[model samples]
Target: MTLGLIGRNAGRLLVPLIFIFGFYIVVHGHITPGGGFQGGAVIATGVALLLVSYYYRDCLERFIPITNFKLVESAGLMLYICTALAGIVVGSGLLFNWLNASGGLFGHPVAYGVNPGDLFTAGTIPILNFAIGIEVFGALSVVTLIMFAGLQEKTQQEEDAEAAESAAPLVSKRKKGKGGRK
Candidate 1:
């Protein structure tokens, strides 16, 4: 089959996979090479696919409403700031590690092994990764939606203009044919 057909047919399957992979990268960021930024960008790819395949005018207005995007983006930023501030409260410098407790809730080890080099050894890194992930995802998704909305609006306006131009000449011709009385 052609590439176009494959892309269209597989988009439904591929989009979810992209989201899962992006989440995996974000969650395991501190342990591996991937991080929030990478994961958020990856997730954005899924959103992009949806935007490309569907009519985003309604979807953008409904799911990614401008007001909602603004709110989520602001909340993500505040959460990141508060998380960083938490480091200072715990006697560690900004974005410091191991100032409070390592790992997630319940004192579970963030990484494997007892040493700092382990996958879960990083203290605040994972939290930081999560915070950055939310922020980046919100910001990028909002930006994408905004751009898509703008493009759609512009295209619609152009289509309206073209239709009006085509109809205007036809109307004028008809009027002239009718002796220009009306």
Candidate 2:
């Protein structure tokens, strides 16, 4: 059985907040202690919590489809690769920080010493951060969901087997007179 009502309700409330925190970590990765990988892991944990709080069939079919996760994972990887190739296309080295201090999107000069952070100053780092975040979130969530599904299936199979075994009639191994067959 899945988590009870209280756990489900708590998970419902917490999932959105967890996702928001994950995004925040990804967005501020260049200046903050957390980044895409960390944020994605957090998001995956939230997904796992939600998954565990509900029936696998109910949740898997209605919310977390494996196909969707696969698509998201692929898309994130493509985005990351494309972003890196963009630099190469512009005659810069692969994964180069050409956007830094270029007076363009996500381009801004940073002060030499410690100072307030600027969200737009990290160039391709933030983009990479987001890409990696999406990839990791999808990958981890899918893994967890699939693992849970497998466990559920195994449990159901075992329960069915037990029930069948119990329902089957018992057979006598010995005759009434074992020493002398009747």
Tens digits of lDDT, candidate 1, 1-182: 11245665687778899999999999889667899999988988887787775456534466667678668668767878987887688745776664334445523544445545444445666777877877787788888888877764533344445666666666667654544222
Candidate 2 error regions (>4 Å): 153-182
Candidate 1: segments with Cα more than 4 A from true spot: 1-9, 99-120, 153-182
lDDT of 2 by residue, 1-182 (tens): 56678998998999999989989998899997999899999989888887777666755557758889889899889999999999998746899988888889898888888988898997899999999999999999889878877764534345446655564445244532232222
List of clashing residue pairs for candidate 1: 110-120, 111-120, 112-120
For TM-score, the strongest prediction is: 2
What lDDT, from 0 to 1, does candidate 1 have?
0.70
- Candidate achieving the largest lDDT: 2
The C-alpha TM-scores of every prediction are 0.67, 0.81
